[model samples]
Target: MFQGRLVQGYDFVDGDTDPSEVGAPYVNPAYGHGTHVSGIIALVAPEARIMPIRVLDENGEGDFWRIAEAIVWAANHGADVVNISFGYPQQTQLLRDLLDACSDGTTTTGKTFPEIGINRLFFSIAAGNSGDSTFIYPAADADDSNGSLAIGASTRFDRLAQFSTFHNRVKLVAPGENIVSAIPGDRYAFWSGTSMAAPIVSAVAALVKARYPNLNPVEIAERVEQTSVRISYGNPQIRINRVDALCAVTLIPPATCNP
Candidate 1:
């Protein structure tokens, strides 16, 4: 999948393209996207079982219904945490209902919370790379107590990534720029986007889940946020969280965590 039309080589510099515009075959901008996200999860929580679900095509383009269906499938199949790196610009009732139902412990979504041995499945989502305050869906659907976390992207310099989407929905940020992870054909590449950030947070979330299986998903998400390192971006008053895996899983909050 790393082999894209009109694209050659595999490295930090050789990645990224517009598959639709180029009419590329088998290789799109999002070619090998799944592997990159999954690789980060495996890196952080080496023992966690990674379920690679296909809801979008090679270009990261997908319909909301398909995404909604994927969520239900993952939750029912004993997935403790679901990582959603893609989002739409608009909100839809179908997604809201499905996520709400999951949090409410209803079996309406073809899965019941009790069946999975957890109160609710957690979702670590990307806030989009729009680089503005515009609202993004699914992530925007985060206001509810559904264990849904809206994450933004930050750079190595400890500042918000210029391309990361941020607003009231986003509660945390993580290193997303120049991130190196696995791709198809057993290769690696450096990709940048909120897509890269969510998995890091989700990986940590999985660790928290394994350490405290009985904790509610919301509680788990909160712990991650509460123990995060606070970062101020363009606006001094506007601060965002940077997840601290050690703080989230440990009994005591680390010095890096905000009081």
Candidate 2:
């Protein structure tokens, strides 16, 4: 069933291109966060292609400038969706500029539309693990007007995770606590964090994109948001919603399913 359905993927984290290297002690001793993320995307959108671009190191540290460049690379290489499982505590102008450019259908280096006819690319970013409403780069910058989705972590009980950062910028929440996914060495493990949550949104975006190829990033993001299950988790000041894939795929116009 998995044959001929393999999707091309990219990894921006550190270590060798070989996903198995994630199991090596010197490579990704942290246990393959990128690989795990890719696995989730594949599971959610089994027919979509994935491209791995290594940007962050084994310690999950990377330069903002490099990340900006990676976004351009993904766009130029025909990537329909980009999933960012990492976040910075503070915002940076450079990152903001790159993301804004992407939303406007341009590259950071001033390049215009690609040959693929795609204007804007979708991005799903993790809120942060700081457990506060403090702003995190990229995620905090994610605006619905710009076709980006900022994701926070929510528990299976429909409550926000204590470690998840909250803010008005957060667009959606997903099941992230103790979530099980693929690790290196053909293994599966339970992981938790906004990192885990962001990919869920990314995968959902992929599904929406695959089903509705005509929808732009903004429309796709809207479908994901509108079809979500609303949850009033503790913070009255913020509205948190969990993704509902079935509703997104089956619901029609002017009709929504919110549980």
Candidate 3:
């Protein structure tokens, strides 16, 4: 069993510090979104520890500044991979700056978090469900050149989901339609959205990290993208790729798989 704690940071939403309280009635009243995300990660890498920071409330909404603070806290508290499944339509300078700083291995204000060097933290964010080319904060900030990955939704048939937001910022797509995962009250449910897709990427990241602990965030992302299956969709033939867990963990170089 994985030994870890769920960190609670939502002042507007009530939660418990006790890890057992996770997914309990009042702790995750928003239909178990955070719990579901955490469950996906655990399934992917059972050996890795999960740190759930409650930045969003039951409604899947939270203050941007509070979200920024959670990022800082995660970095400071030994977070190797942070999975953010929520997004905003518009990018705010404050949120962008915070993410940029976090990517550079510092706090939102340029100060470095102790023990965590520059660019050590990696973030996997959702591209949102706008079904357009609109950009979403944090996800839009994903720089593959850095350690961040912006994920879109892919159907079981290897096609992009109708509701998934797409743009140049998105690095890859994953299975997000009718995904069965854990929910509150010890139940499981099938959910869809770019939010669901983001955690799948996060789980793969954890596997990559576990296999190659020396690799930085950028290297891990490169491994993921390089090992994915290329797929094309849309009228103009837009090209994207889907994550292949075997290729990522085997450390096979890019182009080794059939396209």
Rank the candidate models, highest lDDT first: 3, 2, 1
Which lDDT tens digits does candidate 3 get at residues 76-182? 77788889898887777776665556655544456444534443677789999999999888799887675788999999988999999998889799999998888
Model 2 misplaced stretches (Cα beyond 4 Å) = 1-30, 106-119, 253-255
TM per candidate? 0.83, 0.85, 0.86
Error of 1 at 209 (Å): 0.6
Score candidate 3 by TM-score against the native: 0.86
The positional error of residue 102 in candidate 1, measured at the CA in angstroms, is 1.7
Worst ten in a row by lDDT for model 2: 14-23
Worst 10 residues of 3 by lDDT: 5-14
Using lDDT as the measure, name the better of candidate 1 and candidate 3.
Answer: 3
lDDT of model 1, residue 98: 66
TM-score of 2: 0.85
Residue 52 displacement in candidate 3 (angstroms): 1.2
